[model samples]
Target: MGDHFFRKLWQGTAPLVLWASHFFFCYLYAASGCRRETWAVLLGATLLALAGAGWLAWKAWRGGGEASLGVLHMARLGGAILALAAIAWSAMPLLVFGRCG
Candidate 1:
């Protein structure tokens, strides 16, 4: 019983952790009010985070067959795409607000 419960919990949470980081990182940058430098930083950090997540998924895949790297990897890639989009979206405010002016 406990085994099944823990297994399910872990299964559910593993991807959430990977995805949540991207979400949180974006949220942090967004809430700070957009700026050109910050936008670049956010984009760079997001790419690095995505790369790290990819590495983790690859490691998990190569480690054992029981690991669900597919779900984790998909979640990571989706999160990264979303983060990139969000960062780009946030950049609009900076650009419109006359950072270029």
Candidate 2:
């Protein structure tokens, strides 16, 4: 927590946000019960899940894989990326249709 007191918070929250977004959107789409080539959306979700795991593994490898700290570090980073992507993807509807202010 020396140099990363707030840094880790940012890193950790990203994945949490992404995970939340994934579920939110997926459910939103599913609830509509409409069918129109869902592969793209499904693929995005799959990639995000895989990215989180990959990030953890990357940290483990970078840290020699002897300590659990590395694994955790990688996981947070992965979540951060996924979260960011989720946020971006979620915004598409807003951008296309414009949101009310």
Candidate 3:
């Protein structure tokens, strides 16, 4: 029971956590100094976050089963989707500005 609870907790929160971490890293990196490598770092972080969120969403979608688990999986799916959107949105400034301003 404890393991199951923890697993569910991870599934529901992991994507958001990844998104938040990526957001933090981007700002921190940009603030440190907009070096020539800044774009590369941001791009890498964005791709990694997107991949993580996508994988979580896929897992949530594929893990669906029993009625009781449906809600939990749905929550996981929703969180993953939200994270995906947030991460993409957060990366937009990099694309639009094309450099630290």
Q: How well is each residue in 1-101 modelled by candidate 1, as lDDT tens digits?
A: 99986774554345446556666776787678756576666566666666655555554445445544566545544544554455455445545654321
Per-residue lDDT for 12 in model 3? 79
Error of 3 at 87 (Å): 0.3
Error of 1 at 10 (Å): 6.7
Better of 1 and 3 by lDDT: 3
- Pitting candidate 1 against candidate 3, the one with the higher TM-score is 3
lDDT of each: 0.56, 0.57, 0.88
Give the best candidate by TM-score: 3
Error of 3 at 15 (Å): 0.7
The residue pairs in collision within model 1 are none
lDDT of 2 by residue, 1-101 (tens): 56776676655565676567566866686566545545456557646655764564355346544544664566665565555565456546534643232
The better candidate by TM-score, 1 or 2, is 1
Give each model a TM-score. 0.49, 0.45, 0.89
- Candidate 2 deviant stretches above 4 angstroms: 1-4, 60-101
Worst 10 residues of 2 by lDDT: 92-101
Give me the runs in candidate 3 sitting further than 4 Å from their true place: none
List the candidate numbers ranked by lDDT, top first: 3, 2, 1
Instruction: Return the TM-score for candidate 3, rounded to 2 decimals.
Output: 0.89
